[model samples]
Target: MSRRTVLVTGATGTTGSRVLAGLRQRGVAVRPASRRGAPAFDWGDQDTWVDALVDIDTLYVVPPIEDSPTGVPRGMGDISGFCKYAVKQGVDRFVLLSARSGRAGNPEVVAVEDVVKALGVEWTILRPSAFHQNFAENFQLNSANPLRQSIVDGSLEAMDLGSPIDFIDAADIADVAVETLVGTGHHGQTYELSGPRAFPFAEAVRIIARTLDRPIQYTEFQPTAWFERLRATGVDETVIGLVEHVLHSHDSGVFAGEFDTVERLLQRPPRSFEAYVRETAALGVWDMNQAANKAMQHQR
Candidate 1:
């Protein structure tokens, strides 16, 4: 009997990489399919997807970039095309990495899922909230673009997020993905993962300070006050608009469901915001004080 091979699309990302790592730790055969990675499956590039899907029993679909709300650079209608082709081939077991807010069973992911289901493939869907890795990898950090932010109460209500988001660590999400691949229990269910507890941004920042021993703070900023401060810092108009959009959304109560799905999935509670802040801080992932620190140094 041949060993089952699991193909992971988007192999380089936060969730995908963790999936790969988790699978490897459990001794499952994982073929990473990404443009520059081992199996060479580019979501936009059809030939690559077909090549990688050969003899593959399971797939972790992270979706092509264009489907993302932040707007990816991929071409139009990428999702439909990928599913059509995957079904033609005999690939089975598709696990999708869908957004917490967008996963309202959108025509997008749902459409592909439907196709896979029609093909009689086993499926599991994971809708996870905003990742903690965002603080380190995304454009939101203080070091990359220096800014003095007084924004506080970063508490996002979770229902607007399309569901309660316990904000599961990418690593935990990966563990579940690998478990589904290796173990049999999660085949027909959809799992929503989040951290054990949800705290507002101010409290989250305080945890960062406690963990890193840095005096970092989270200050609340109204739109007007935020605009003025960003203007003084000479923040670009484009960047300012995006920040405003996020703030407006959060403040308006779009994300109301925040707290504890990670523990539910992993049987162990997810890491806390403080652990993320502290761990990242100790690792120089971001100097919580680095941004304002730079602003202060330059002002003197």
Candidate 2:
């Protein structure tokens, strides 16, 4: 029997990296496809696609989002074309990392989902909620890099979204993705993965403050103010727009939905916000002094 090789796109990203580790730990043959990874792949560069698809029967795709020069959110461009090419390459299975809100609110995600489903292959879609890692990794709070600065000093802005969000951990998303990729009975299924419970951003900040033993404040921000703050920090305009869109959707009560999909798939309750905060705090993810020093040095 020939060994099955799986290609993981966005291989170094939050969820993709975790998926790669999980696959490797399970003794699965895996190929990481990224602009920097071997057999490099770029969503905008079609020439790099074919080489990365070689000898790969399964694919784990996380669509790349890049900023547009026009300051608009650029969705995955031409995913249908890529799906067609992948089908021609004999790829038999696909797992797409989509968002719970995107299924209804974002046309680009809907189009990508449609393309993957039409491929006539085993496909599983993961629609996950806001990731808990955003606070420590993507969002401008407690980031380790000097180039990024916190949008708010010592205070975090919470969207007045009118409801609580069930932010899932990236690791839990990875676990479920691994199972869907390598295990049985998950084909043609769409799983909405979320944390065990929903809570407002103020509550989340309180949990983080308690876990980290620090004084962190959460202030409710209107959508316009949030957009301006992100823009002032030199964030990509497209990303800022997307953030505003999601915040508006949340305010409209779109992202408050929760599910037991994670528990059912992994046979364990998904990691909670408190647990994520505790683990991250242990790793010094919320160290204000370190972050302040880095920012100060960068300014010099």
Candidate 3:
């Protein structure tokens, strides 16, 4: 078989970046596509699609979640246009990065999945729960790193959804994505990827505190309170909306379920939250002294 050149959209993003790295590590030919990358690709600009699709036999798609000018979260309106275009250009296999909620018929995600399936190509959909890296990367609390505002001022609070969440590691998601993309027997499969167990947000805080040997408290906030808190910090409304959506979904028990798909597909147990925390701690990512020094510097 000729070398497979897989086009990975959203190549620079969290999960997409991991997927790209995994593909590269496996020695598969990959074309990383982003708005600014060479052979650039943009969801809103149809004209840029063909170049990104050129000579590609496999595709890894991460649909863009855009922010409306008014601050609401918006989905890729209709990916069918791009899906049909890719089919005509000769791409044969597809792996879509969708959310766990999408399996329950989230309209936007369903629209994209529908298009891929209707295109008559081999396809696999990965629906993963919230990523564990959200704490270290997006939320910023997992870091013993000083809160943008001093923790003394109560400026930083962990939003509790009043439920347990199955937080999967991004690396695990990438592993499954690679397998589905290059391996067989996954066609027409919609796997709900998650960590081995579900734990409440409070438990996550405790884990960080124990692993880092720091005092970290978990605070429960109503959706409205959390929204106002983020706004007060000058967080973008679009990002706040996305956060609210996920937290609210958690509150509603949307992410409370665990899945064995990760283990089943990878043929090994999914990495646990504790393992992630232990490894991260070893990296000194949660050093309290370092965070405090950074905070003090910012204050000065």
User: Who wins the lDDT comparison?
Assistant: 2
TM of each candidate vs. truth? 0.71, 0.85, 0.82
Candidate 3 per-residue lDDT over residues 1-300, each given as its tens digit: 235789998787777888899989999999998988998888778889878988898999887664432122145454667777888899989898888666545555566777777779899988888788766653321334333232323234765577898999999999999888878888899899999999887787778777767676556667788678768978898676556555566667778778899888889999999999889778764565676787799999
User: Candidate 2 — worst ten consecutive residues by lDDT sum?
Assistant: 139-148
- Candidate 1 local Cα displacement, residue 41, angstroms: 1.9
lDDT of 2 at 119: 92
Candidate numbers, best lDDT first, in rank order: 2, 3, 1
Scored against the true structure, residue 201 in model 2 reaches a CA lDDT of: 75
Those runs of model 3 whose alpha carbons end farther than 4 Å from true positions after fitting are 1-3, 68-75, 138-156, 227-248, 292-300
Task: Give the per-residue Cα lDDT of candidate 3 at 87.
Answer: 84
Ranking by TM-score: 2, 3, 1
Which is better, 1 or 3, measured by TM-score?
3
Q: What clash count goes with each model?
A: 17, 0, 0
Task: Superpose all Cα atoms of candidate 2 onto the true structure and report the RMSD in Å to 1 decimal.
Answer: 4.0
lDDT of 2 by residue, 96-149 (tens): 998776644665566678778999999999989888887777522123432112
TM-score of 1: 0.71
